[model samples]
Target: MTTEEIEKVTERGPAASAGVTRRLGPATGRPSEASVLNVFSHGILVVWALMVGVPLLWVLWSAFKDSNGILTDPWGLPTVLHWENWSNAWNDANMGQYFVNTAIVVGGSVVGTMVLGSMAAYVLARFTFPGNRFIYYLFVAGMSFPVFMLVIPLFFVLRDFPGSSLLATYHGLILVYIAYSLPFTVFFMTAFFRTLPTSVAEAAMIDGASHTRTFFQVMVPMAKPGLISIGIFNFLGQWNQYLLPMVLNQQEDKYVLTQGLAMIALQQGYENDWGALMAGMMIAMLPVLIVYSIFQRQVQSGLTAGALK
Candidate 1:
């Protein structure tokens, strides 16, 4: 071959060898790193799903079973649906009243947290002010402080709160939930607000909209995903909160669902009314599960919005 032909063959030799190597690479018995990792990750996810789903399914089916069945075959499916368990739990256990109280307290606190948190976040994100970073960091710091450490001090503060003792009252508990939830709400919203487009806000201002009107009418609508996300989070936290209410809400009649459930668990141990207890647990869990199911997409969008920007 000529010198040019030799040069061409030399180049083709490496290219042909690389093609052969690429084709043979997967034929070897060993799995690729990516496929192995993918299988491992999927296995982990499946295991995790089973871990979480099994108990929830157990609780759901148990709610329909009689007390005897629950004791006899905890893992087995319900043989006969006992619907009275729900009514018994609701009325006999005072779960109905507790459910109402929970709704009221959690509803009010969620609204309050969103309104206050969003406003604070909007200001911190959109404007420069004295102590802006200081205030923002202060909220961030609040998240790090353990709730257990504040329970005792919170008890006294609510008890001696000016005008009336906030202890054991619905509004009082609502206020505490708002405070407990604010730090994370504010922190989350502040980051989310920063990701929003400033042009829309500035345009609203140029259109002669006052700051208050601009925020409520213009900005809030745009931040709906974030609001829904944080609202659900706060609702879940405040709803399931045991310690704060346990300490602050001492009144039996005004007890929230968590307190009611604890009481039911204690009483059921002696009363042997396991069916009603299971039903009560379902009632408590239903609201949270329903809310999250409805807003799951919004929550995911809100969480990723900042990262996307």
Candidate 2:
């Protein structure tokens, strides 16, 4: 292990010396670091996907089982494929009406939030008027406050809105959703708007483009990525809204998907129709799953594209 072995290895030439060195420690050195990391990462991702996916699959299969079947064989697949559970959830439970009400409210709110939020962001990002920072901060303050904290005051405000109360009305719910979504939308789009090049709007202005024209034709088109991102966020939030509708929308006919699901779950009582409940959960989840699957690429791209710019 001393000078004799060292001289013997050196006498064997560089290749043999390298072979001895290799035999002294790990045959493959640190090159497998990335490979190890890759496996580890994939392992983590697989675990995460299974954690999310297994529960969802359980819900989907349980929709096809009756109360007794579900309770008895909780982990097993459906034996009968009880499609009547869907019909019962859709027809008997009035999920159809709830879905329609949800679609209308969410659709209106997403549109309103996008339109108003984008315009406000444009003005705030581009203009240097007095109170611009103050106004931006005012909008941002909405995000800082919890929705629960504001719900009490908001309830009173909506109920006392002029002659007729806005409570339980479609427009009222839509307006409230828009108000809640705006802070995040405006904040996101404002940052995105600032990142956009000013030259396009300036060029449009030089060609005698009006302010409105420039905004609609020039700025809005450029900010489409940001709009898509915020629009999706607004849609998801408004679509799954429960508490707001539960409190404000006290009318039975005006229930959203979340409200309807809760109603079904609560109405289950001692003799619970777990199958129908599972079926209703799937019905509510379907739209969101479809939407996320469809626009996932756009969602990922639109949200991050501006940052790279």
Q: Whose TM-score is greatest here? A: 2
Ten residues in sequence with the least summed lDDT for candidate 1: 300-309
Off by over 4 Å in 2: 1-45, 298-309
lDDT of 2 by residue, 113-167 (tens): 9999999999999999999999999998887898898899999999999988999
Best by lDDT: 2
| lDDT of candidate 1 at residue 7, scale 0 to 100 | 92
Model 1, 150-268: lDDT tens per residue? 99888999999999999999899988888878888888888888889999989999999999999999999999877887887787788999999899998988989999999877765
For each candidate, the alpha-carbon lDDT, in order, equals 0.86, 0.87
TM-score of each: 0.83, 0.84
Q: Which parts of model 1 have CA positions greater than 4 angstroms off?
A: 1-28, 31-47, 268-270, 299-309
Pairs of residues at least 3 apart in sequence or in different chains that clash in candidate 1: none
